[model samples]
Target chain A: MHVMIIGAVGMLGKKLASVIAKTRQCNGQSVTRLTLVDIAVAETPENPAFPIESLAFDLSHTDTAPLLTKRRPDIIFHLAAIVSGEAENDFEKGYAINLDGTRHLFEAIRRERDRNGNAADYRPRVVFTSSIAVFGGPYPDTISDTFFRTPQTSYGTQKAIGELLLEDYTRRGFMDGVGLRLPTICIRPGLPNKAASGFFSSILREPLVGQPATLPVEDTVRHWHASPRAAVRFLLHAGTMDSSRLGHRRTLNMPGLSATVAEQVEALRTVAGNDAIALIRREPNPDIAAIIAAWPQDFTADRATDLGFRAERSFEDIIAVHIEDELGATSA
Target chain B: MHVMIIGAVGMLGKKLASVIAKTRQCNGQSVTRLTLVDIAVAETPENPAFPIESLAFDLSHTDTAPLLTKRRPDIIFHLAAIVSGEAENDFEKGYAINLDGTRHLFEAIRRERDRNGNAADYRPRVVFTSSIAVFGGPYPDTISDTFFRTPQTSYGTQKAIGELLLEDYTRRGFMDGVGLRLPTICIRPGLPNKAASGFFSSILREPLVGQPATLPVEDTVRHWHASPRAAVRFLLHAGTMDSSRLGHRRTLNMPGLSATVAEQVEALRTVAGNDAIALIRREPNPDIAAIIAAWPQDFTADRATDLGFRAERSFEDIIAVHIEDELGATSA
Candidate 1:
């Protein structure tokens, strides 16, 4: 089957492409072609593999829909979005890319299918990567998959709106859509991010690099999380799932460990020893405190789990994912 | 306290204005001034009890925010909306009025407060009239206030987005916002509407005027609703309640009666008797049937009751409201 990744260059995007490119079998099965797409120029990987097409073009322009319709891959991995902090900072740009760009994709595919009339059985499965940020303040118990999404940030608000549109369009028979509400990715690769949750991964990634990391939040602060590897797995699984089983509730909250900052410190000590823990600095930021307070500390992802969606079982496993996948190390 | 009603010319808007204007008290307390806002040209009612201002200018225009800040009323009944049926037909206009216009009001209030700092002391309670359209597709036993809002229509989508912004802005202390998810307004005044659910009101309303009316669905199809009087009471209650008591989670499922179309028909007979029933035409429009099929049948509005919000005791009261309010008859 032909697979396409809209944002095939970002952290999870790259991981997804690499995983699908190699693992010729999943629970024992054969793989085929992979198509990668993004606004920026993407490079074709080396070695013999399925035919590759790299496109460096803006998807927000009005006509991008026609182009995507032309590409018509069987499975679509839509992982691109305006990050939270940046989206909040640049409101117009964020809405343009996140809201407008997403609509363009759905509309394009919708037009194609409308013309095709479902006779050829040619509808592609589109997996949308959503976030826990979709849920907001005054949470009751653990936020169930059915919790009303009252996003606090502009980014969260945009994503929640996106989820609504996806469901509406899908209900109208536009495409086979599945939105996965991913937990905050822990032990993220690359430089420390300006994201409020970046410190979660930074404390691990930075110390592993023999550098000091600042812990902005307190030890008792708990949050939802999964690893980049797990995120990729979720995308793959969503791509392969049967749409009939999903019914109308196309969005699912993926699993994650609900651990506090203190727990993360403990896991870090176990991973890189107490010396690395000693390298961590304490600091306080009230702006972040307000944002963190609105977030759900955990979720009861009964729906996603029942659907076979999975995530890291422990913070240590999350830390290890970074070491093996990103830190140039084989299985320990 | 000073109160303002936007979109005062619409059916419910005008009814709410009249109720509040004639009131000796709102939420059992005296109200001082009432401002009625709309884009259409309107004249100040000669018999307006308290201070009343009727303005005729587009609230969706660029300059509305500053103009509103200058007026700066203490309590705002933000009943302004593009309306469901109209919004669904015109996408761009729906977004501009329903979404951008709301943002403009909030931003205007924010800027006004920013200029005066805490000394502004000008924060007003805002009551947003949301709709049951916020809940779509997934039919369950009873929709809790905790149920996720997965709107099916573009209009519902806009309202859901508005509720999110209202919650976040209220939480930020820029405003105190309360959103009431009203069920379908039954016994609506004037000519029949193209709205999918318009048949609910048309069946009774048109027949009362000695005209034939159409019934769209089976009597067994149930939905939630409050009488016009109950809806106005909800607005007044929301405006006067102590919002600090609410803390966060400002949006609420306004109390309503869960009645079937058959019960409504029975209520019509109870009021107008056999003559009113004979004027009803038995016909179902497929387009409306498609839309109504996905609508929620009932909601467990336990939260609203606890908050002191009220709805009609029965469908009998709803039909009686139409007689007492619209037909100018105290006794049917």
Candidate 2:
């Protein structure tokens, strides 16, 4: 099996690559080769059991997609995207990269299938990373699987569009596609990216490591989240799952823990003590608060749960995963 | 008020144009000019109260959108699309005209807004015609406002994507937009188009006019529908309505009558007598039946209803509408 990971330089991408490298397989198939692609060349995973190739390509450029699909990887994990805050701030750049970039890749795959002559011979499993951002507010207490997507941000709109394209292309037999609407990754490792939800992670991650982090929204503000480990699991499951089970709706609202900022702080106290909670500096930013307000606070995620996807039961479990994985802790 | 219709040559587009020509105003504002655009030059409406220009253009061409938006009409009615059957048959043409074409028009509007210097100076009302095709089957008894869009066809996917763009662009303040998810127009006049739903109209239309029409699906098949007159009213309402009422979710499920094929035949019998009903031929084309099966059968368009949009109360009313509007009947 040849596995390709787009946006492989990003935090989740790197971790996913490391996991794949250690496993030496995907969906029970032996990994013959692995390809890591991003805007910059991704670093090689240590002691990989398979041949690994790294490529730097900007998918927004129309030509880049064809090059990426030239080798026809058996499974393609598309995690590349302009983060929410950046996309909201720069409309054209957001559409170019997030929307056009995704479409170009899908089109490339379709063209490759056409070139193969036997259409059935080249259909790859395309695992697309979507986000809860596809949903907007005035949401029910628990957003159901059937909740409509009325995205308030350009980034969300682009992602929603990508989901539509993914399902359509998959239905047309261009590819076997699965879209995972990943919840915001709690305690995301590394420095914050431009995503509006970055603070959700930064507040917890920075404090646990004895560093001060700004809390942009009030403690009462609630949001959905899952650990990096859970997100990676969701990706693998989507990549390997039987497409027939998905029916016509290829996207799933991933199961996640819903926690308010106050609850998150309490979880930090439970896991890392009072000093860690004290590191959280409350500095309200209305802009961030407004954006967060328009986001979904919780979801039923019944469909995903029924499909065998799972998430942390509590915020402490999420923080524990971050500690074990990123802080080099053997046990939480 | 300056009005522009993108698909001015289409059945609904022509009717909308004729109505505008007769009204001499839109949204209580005096009509100044009307621009009609299509792949072919549209015929001018008879005895116009304002100057009207018909232009032949394809929106899929990148340059065409800019030209259409050069004058910046006060209200833009984008009714252009590749119908469902045609879009499904030709993949490239579907995405080219339905998806890219809509994007180009939107981009053009945004650029035109930018060129105006003050972002507030040239914002126009963009009325986009979406379809019930955005919702697929395995549906609720009556689809609610918050039901997710899982389009089963390429044309539907394109419209759902367009709706997302409309909301995002509108939210960004580039243009004031409203998207109406029009139900199938029943008892349609003239020759049937390539839409998979064409038979829904033809079965009623042809028989009423003393022509034999094929019924490809069983009498048990249920579907949602509205009349051409009601569709025009929805467009006019969308074009003139105070958009602030829409909040962030701009697209709406327009009110429609839900009826079975048997019910439609009964309505036809009542309206045009038993002789007209006998003109219907039941051939049971499985291909068309499969496509129709995936379509939405009913909707509780409470949002659109509360906002003052109305459709026929019964299938009889729908038949009455067709007879009065198309058959030159003084009374039903």
Candidate 3:
């Protein structure tokens, strides 16, 4: 099977590409070629057995998706997006990348239906990255699968709209799709300060590397879902899942931790010893607090669970996964 | 109270404007003026007691919403949109008017905060006309308020996206808002053709006025909700409801009928005699039947009902509303 990863140079995209390359196959078939897409040309993931190609064009460019579709990969991992903070800062640019860019990608796949001759199985499987920020303000006791999305930021709203489109387009057979609404990726490897949730991981990743990191919100502030390993696994699982059973609602909220900042700090202390916990600074920025409060605290992913997706068993597992990925496996 | 009715010349727009004119006042003050806006000049409602202003400007044009927001209405009823058929027929036009126009309106109201200093008492109320098309596809037993929107058309997709924006913008305190997902309006008092469902009403409405009317779907077909009177009342009620109880999700599924086409025909026969029913033609359009079947058969509008929004009790009342509105209350 041929594989493509849009935003292949980014964090999860890089991790996922590496994982797929290492495995070399899914269910015993070889990954013949890998098409890596990003604005800054990505370093092609070296698969000892498979061939590779890379492109550095902006996905929003009218011809990008169609050009990619011409290659006709069996699977497409679409992780490309304008981050929340940047999206909030530049309105038109945000909509251009997150909303219009996505539509362009899907339209490209749909146009392939009769390229040769009309066939039932012409479209490739599409895996889209969504986020938990899709659910916002006035959240219930436990965010259920049935909760209607009331996104607070322009970013969240855009993601929610994308989910709707992915579902409808997939239902119409434009593409076989699975949209995973990721939680904030805990202990995100390398650097903090860009994303609003950068501090969450920055506190952990920086400390493990012997550096101090700021905590913008109070320790009691809670938010939702998963580790980077879990996100990659979720994408892979969604790629191979029995989509016929899921029916029309193609997108889903991936499961994750419901712990507050204090709990996260506690978990870090347990996993890396007291020295790591000492590196976090409690600064309490009200702007960040206001933004965080608008996001849903947790979700009961009943549907995704029923569909056979899984997540880390505990914070120790989350930390262990991060340590193995960022540090050497021996460090954990 | 100052009121503005955008899209005042369209079918529903004219009905709503006429209703608002008769409302007299809101919260104890006399309605001082009524502003009507549309892409073309609007029908001036007979409101001799109040001042009236009509503006002919394309909302899809640059800075349209900002221009309208300058009027500073106490309550603004935004009914401007290309209908589903037209939206599906022309993709670019659909997004331009439905998505971009809606955003422009919200952005304009958001700007009002900076210029006016956002007093607690000063924010205008924005009411959006959403549609049942927001809920589509082969449905469940009944579409409850909690059911997720899985719209099929470009129109439905746009409306669903519009609902998300309305919620987010309203939550941020840009302005108070309410979105009403109205059912397919029956007995639409107009010409005899077009709109897949136009035949549902035309089969009776046209025959009453002595014309041949076609039935595109079987008489056994069933779907959901309201008379124009109830729908107009819904807009008014939504504008005045206690939204504090609604939390961040402000959109409501306004109430209506769940009757079958046979039931509709029976209602018509009872009200207009056998001659009206005799003019019906049994010509089915598959494109329309497919679209109509995908629509929800019934909706459990528990939320809207609990919130105090009501609809006509029966199809008989619906027929009465059409005659009264079109032929006058004294015609009987």
Candidate 4:
């Protein structure tokens, strides 16, 4: 089957492409063609078993979505979005890319599906990478799958809107859509982006690699997380999962380990020894702290667990995965 | 202060205009001008106390929003939308009017607010009419203020998206926005439109007027409602309320009477006698029944009540209001 990944130049997207190329199959069907897209130019992974097409395309532009749709990939992974801080700072750009871009892609697919009056025949499996940011606080300790999405930021609002459109479009039979609400990726494998949640990874990622990193919030501040490897697995599983299982609500909260900053530090100490933990510096930025305060701490993602999507059981396991994936044997 | 009503010719919009004109003030401010616009030609209210301008315009059109923004009405009542059943059947038109049309208005407001670098001064009070359809079922008997919105229909999706935009736009200080999640308007004073919930009104409306009406579902099916008068009052209240108290979430579930179809019939019988009750014929429509089954039945509208938005407490009260307002002494 042909598979397409938009935002395929990003860390998780690259990991997902490499994993699929290595595995050669999804849900027991061989992936015969891979189309990778991003605003940044994507380089084709070496020694892939399938035919590959890499393209740099801005989804917000009018022509790109239709061009992608013309390929008619059987499976589509849509992961492109502006980060939370960027979205908050540049309001118009945020809505233009995150909201309008997603809508354009969905519309393109929908128009293609309706072209022949055989919508059912042409419907593709769409796995949308949503975020836990979709849920804002005044929240319970563990936000359940059914909790209200009153997103506090423009990014969250955009994601929530995308989820709604995905559900609606799926209901209309234009696509088989599954929105996986991913947790903040801890020990992310690259340089930090402008996301408010970046500190969650940086405080762990930098310190463990013998470099000092700043902690913006107090130790009591809790958050949900999955490793980059786990996030890729989530995308793959969502692409393969039974759409019938989702019913009316297309989005499911992916499972993650909930840990306070103290817990994360302890996990880091366990995995990388006391020297690694000592590399962490305490610095408080109230702007970032205030943004983090309104974020959801934990989630009871029982729905995703029930559907067989897995994540690291503890922050130690999350750190171990990151070390193996990014640092390998050279780590402390 | 000038006020604009985008759906000025619709039942709610027309009633709202006449009510405001009769009072000649909104939230204690004298109304100097009224702009009434609709896709159909909007006739200026007879002997309007304020200087009233009526125009035929489609909100979905590209240029209409910019034109409307040029006037910069101090209070904008955006009550325009394609109803649910129509939205479900005609997908493109639903999105064009409900989603894109709403976005255009919001963008226009945002642009005009930013035009002079004095967004705070240009910020207008925008009262948006949302609906209970925003909440799809798997609901609690009394859905609280913070319940998730998982709308099953296209119309509900559109409204949910609108609410998100309203909140974000308000947050950014472009507009002072309030979204009122109105109940199904019981005994709507008009010929039935294509809405699936139309029977909620028709069953009561036709019976009270000594005309036959069909009940499409079982008598045990429960629903939430407010009278047309109460709905108008809710709109006006939303327009005038202390927006500072709204916090970050701009929308509130307006209080309404929750009653079973059996209870509604009982109320109808109390108001118009057994002969009137005899006018309702049971006609089961599986499609509509399925749709209604997925709808929210009740809500704990504590937030709205505390905010001073009120509705009828009993189905009989709703019927009485309909009689006094629509039927009067001429009804059988």
Indicate which candidate wins on TM-score.
Answer: 4
Indicate which candidate wins on DockQ: 2
TM-score of chain B of each: 0.94, 0.96, 0.94, 0.96
Against the reference, the lDDT scores of all candidates come to 0.80, 0.90, 0.81, 0.89
Q: What C-alpha lDDT, on a 0 to 100 scale, does residue B172 get in candidate 2? A: 94
- The clash tally of candidate 4 reads 0
Candidate 1 RMSD computed on C-alpha atoms after optimal superposition onto the true structure: 4.9
TM-score of 3: 0.82
User: For each candidate, what's the DockQ?
Assistant: 0.46, 0.90, 0.48, 0.89
True contacts kept of each: 0.62, 1.00, 0.62, 0.85
Model 4 CA deviation exceeding 4 Å by range: A192-195, A330-332, B192-194, B330-332
Q: Tell me the lDDT of candidate 4.
A: 0.89
Model 4, range A225-332, lDDT digits (tens) per residue? 889888888888898888798889999999998999999999888888899888888898899899889888898999999999999999888888887888875334
What TM-score does each of the candidates earn? 0.80, 0.96, 0.82, 0.97
Return the top candidate by lDDT: 2
Of candidates 4 and 1, the better by TM-score: 4
lDDT of 3 by residue, B44-76 (tens): 755367888889978787578888988789888
lDDT by residue (tens digit), candidate 4, B61-174: 878898998898999999999998889989999999999999999999998887778766688899999998898878888899998899988999999999999999998888
lDDT of 3 by residue, A19-64 (tens): 7778876434567778888988888754356777888878778887
lDDT of 2 by residue, A1-332 (tens): 89999999998898888888888877566778999999999999666667999999999999999998989999999999998888988999999999999999999999998786767778999999999889888888989988888788898999999999999999999999999999888888888665668889998888877899889889999889999999998888887888799998999999999999999999889998999888988989999898788788999999899998999999889988988999889545
Residue B148 accuracy (lDDT) in model 4: 87
Candidate 1 residue pairs in backbone clash: none
